[model samples]
Target: MSTGRLIAAYIFGSVGRGQADALSDLDILAVVENNLGKVAELDVIKLVPLQFASLKPSISWYGAARVAEMFQNGELFAWHLSRETVSLFDPNKFLQTLGTPAPYKECLADVRSFRAILSGIPPQVQQSAVNAAYEAGLVYVCLRNIAMAASWELCEAPDFSRYSVFNLSGLRKCPISVEEFDAAMHCRMASQRGLQPPHTATVSYILGIYSRLDPWLDELEELLLRKENGRQYAQNAV
Candidate 1:
């Protein structure tokens, strides 16, 4: 139960990237030694110093050996930890020892993860405008990740800013406005805070955003397809 047992900890996601806003949560990963069973019993809030109480941390616990295995296997989650983390505690430099992740492979994994999330959305959840708006916001975030991956393949830096994908010249060909997209994102945050916008307005905004994103999704799928084909070809030739 002692915090002293933790070998390493890291802050990641928006906080690690220095992009936190009022609604952002602190995403934390803690590595421990020989206490995997005790993880569930630990009080995470108590482990966090009182100074960070306002940050609303979401914590995940992992054993040191498991983390090392994940890094060696090129798991996307481990890759993210290696690439986008600010070490809170690293007496052993465990995070530093992880090899650099393959960006293309990470991007493809993210695309698949996002697609799974979208596909898992129940039909009933979309019945409410607020719910639809929230779902649309998730979709927009996923699209941004897809755009970043695609951009990386083209030798461009990955842009993680919200809705940055819509600003791409290629995506500008699709019919969507900044205002409409913004509303969907706004509606999502507001809904979480228990403030719902008009149902009709929310639904309209979400529909518009989705319609515009459709073709872009198609393009992303094609990009992944090409990457997979090339990877298979290379493996076959070898």
Candidate 2:
């Protein structure tokens, strides 16, 4: 069972949240005494049962101390674990003892990082047939992560839902329509499932989605700035 070196193990993400479908891949974490941070797949893939190998569970390996540090720092990864992890193996209840993570404080920084990635992708890169689906996937991930981080910055509990983008405070000001965002989401999921239609206009559709991301990011940035300023104002007044 490899329990000698393994300290904690759990499933997280969609499956942890009970939002997964038949097509969803498992997100697993294995905390080992030997590895302190990220470990290679081969280091832990064999620990998974052969029956579940076909599902291709995405596994992560970390050292116990590293997990403690992440929890102490209140990173987004910490919040995710605190909010949505179901224990598969926890003889010592290590994760349970870690308790709630510190408040996430890098919301704006993360949003800006996501913005940089989108900008760096260049229009030509996004338009390429080879990168169209990949670009859409990146956008989907960025929007979801932005929403989660922004929620913490807004003094709200983090929103980790698949559709978290639509749930942000200033989401009404977001330029992207629900339908357009959803189209990209479907494309991302389809790509993950290796589904390519005989005839598809993925390039054109992803470009259209790209057009709206700029204004959407602008809206999020403005909202986050306002919140930060409001906090500063209250602090200065006191």
Writing each residue's lDDT as its tens digit, candidate 2 over 78-151 gives 98999898777789999889998887778889999888777755475554677766677777777777778887
Best by lDDT: 2
Model 1 bad stretches (over 4 Å): 1-4, 38-53, 102-106, 109-113, 116-130, 144-178, 187-201, 231-238
Poorest lDDT segment (10 consecutive residues) of candidate 2? 197-206
Query: Residue by residue across 1-238, what tens digits does model 1's lDDT show?
Result: 4433577788888777778788687888988885544344244445555555688788888888888777776655665686678877777788877666443366666666776665544342456644665676565566556655555443344555565555443433436666665665665566666766535344555555565566666776676678678988999999
The lDDT of each candidate is: 0.63, 0.74
TM-score of each: 0.70, 0.82
Give candidate 2 regions above 4 Å deviation: 1-4, 36-55, 126-129, 177-179, 190-193, 197-201
Residue 225 lDDT, candidate 1, scale 0-100: 71
* Candidate 2 TM-score, true structure as reference: 0.82
